[model samples]
Target: MRQTNEEKINRLEELKETYDRFKEKPFQLNLKRGVPGKDQLALSEPMLNILTPEDLYQETEADFRNYGVLTGIPEAKQFFSEVLEITADEVIVGGNSSLQLMYTVLASKMFLGQSDKNSAWAKEKVVKFLCPSPGYDRHFNATEKLGFELIPIEMTSTGPDMDQVEILVANDASIKGIWCIPTYSNPTGVTYSNEVVDRLAKMKTLAQDFVIMWDNAYVVHHLKEKKEHVQNVLETSKSYGTEKRVWMFCSTSKITFPGAGVAALGACKENIDWVTEVLSDQTIGFDKVNQKRHVKFLKDKKHLLQHMEKHAELLKPKFDSISNLFGNYFGEESTMLEWTEPNGGYFVHLTTMDGCADRIVELLADIGVSLTEANASYPYGVNPRNNSIRLAPTSISVEEIEAAVKAICLCVEMVSLEKELDSNK
Candidate 1:
């Protein structure tokens, strides 16, 4: 039976007692970022000693210990090519951070321009990039730092609302690009469907040199038996003569050591040549030693998938715990509270009742549980509804996950009840 106003008030009092009990417990848990735990990091420990002196001087004999191989060694390029399913010529094996590579791509276009015509976006009157909400904060921060006005687009289950994307881009010449996490999007774990990919490929834009920053960070990070395969954006755009519009990025940061893993960017021939030419002045090359290390450790796509399965084995239980706890606490009887059960990504996005997210976060913090800041997923650090909270269950242990999630559920229910009772008054 649905609870009456009086019943809700009584429930709030009971929840407050539990909340006070939580405050008395001595524990500090941080779930602010999606990071691989110690166990996950331990899985890649063997890679540190996988190489030797002779291994460094491979078939190319390019001298891994020396400077040069500006765009990356041929073998490194080939490895990432198979990973991204793009041609070897289309890949540029970069340094440790894919985020850095992404920033470089945007900064390159902002200053030097995207083509031979030298149409620098920095010279333009106003430039904007479409950002899908409940998306990655770093993506928003990157473009915002580059002076591109960040526009929030509604993120649907399939992907960003393409109709809205199409309408906005078709009318605004100043809208230069959009940030996309195509497969297993950050926080939401939304993989773009074929229709969404097709619409994005064929969409008309006022800006002739518009681009798509495809950050496929979680491409192979699957948590279930069934893997999702998004349509080939590069091929789809090629049919529309929009091949130059796609700039795809990926990295083995999560698979191996985050601070030392290899990253790469995939693009059309023109983009490859353009970025290569631009990068020439910037550096001699990325860390070839680390590149060779990852190449030998991960080996091929099959082995890479095998490696990720290990990650899933460790992560699946934590995610399952979160799901089961949510069902137990916030069951069908709950109102105006929901969350995404992501398949592959590192976050579970929670939506609390309106005006309740901030309070829920505050309440959890009081009990020594730290979460990602409320509204950290949106552009400018603001969710208009103020109802979104991102939960990262990757870094902590399974026991900590259960404790944290239970505390979260209690706080969520308490906050919701408090809101309901206040409104009734």
Candidate 2:
């Protein structure tokens, strides 16, 4: 039964006392980013010792200590090919950050265009990129900085609202591209269904040079026994002869070392050639020594999966702790808040009742818990409803997570009661 107004007012007063008590305690806990825990990082420590002086040269007589493999070392390319499920020729292994590769590709398209077949996107009067909401903020920031009008697309359980995507792109010549984290997406943890993937591949766009930025950062980061697989964008696009329109990226940033991991891009042969040609002017090549090191450490896709299972073992408990606490505090029937229980991926997305998220975040901050800014998953850091909060439980200890979560639950109840009390008045 719902509480009477008088009871709610009394409860609010009691909660205010508890809030005052919390303020008296002093501690700092951060959930701002999805960084790997100490234990997770420790798992890859053996990688640093894998290389020796004798292993410095490849069988092809290429000196890894020197330079000259512009695309990538053959072994590195072969390893990424197995990881990306593409041929070695289709992959262009890059530096430690896949985000850098993505930025370069977009910048290239903006100024240079994909090929002579189309004009540069910068030449267009107004260029726009489709961003699926409850998505990655870094992606939105990138496009916005590059001067593209960031159009927000509604994200569903299966994927983006394709009906809207289909209609908008088909009618608007300015809608040039879409950003996708197709499998185990950043905050929401929703994977694109096969049908959604097929539609994206075959969709008719008004822009002849429309692009799809597929960042598969969590492809091997599985938290459950069953591994999630997304339909291959490059292979799917091949049927429609749209392979060049897809640029896929993956990295060992989370797999091994964020600072010195291997990153790669998978695209059509033509696009790979184009990127290779453009990159020749950027630098001699990425650090081949590190590339060779990763190849030695990871060895193959099978070994990569085995390594990721260790990550899952470390991460699964933290995710479970969040889920259990949320359920206990809010209950199955609560309408005040809802959160995702992702099978894989780094974040849990919590959505409070409409108009309450910002207040909750502010309350948490006052007591020294840092969350991703409210509605950060949306483009321009705005969610008109003001209800989304991305929770990152990876970096902190489970004990800290418990304390932080309990504090959050208290704040949720306090804010929710306050909302109802005001509504009744």
Give the top-scoring candidate (lDDT): 2
Write model 2 residue lDDT over 29-55, tens digit each, in one string.
899888888899999899889999878
384: Cα error in model 1, Å: 1.3
Native-referenced Cα lDDT, model 1: 0.90
TM-score of 2: 0.98
Write model 1 residue lDDT over 364-416, tens digit each, in one string: 88999999889888999888799989998899999999999888988888888
Give the backbone clash total of model 2: 0
- Residue 386, model 1, lDDT: 92
lDDT of 2 at 210: 93
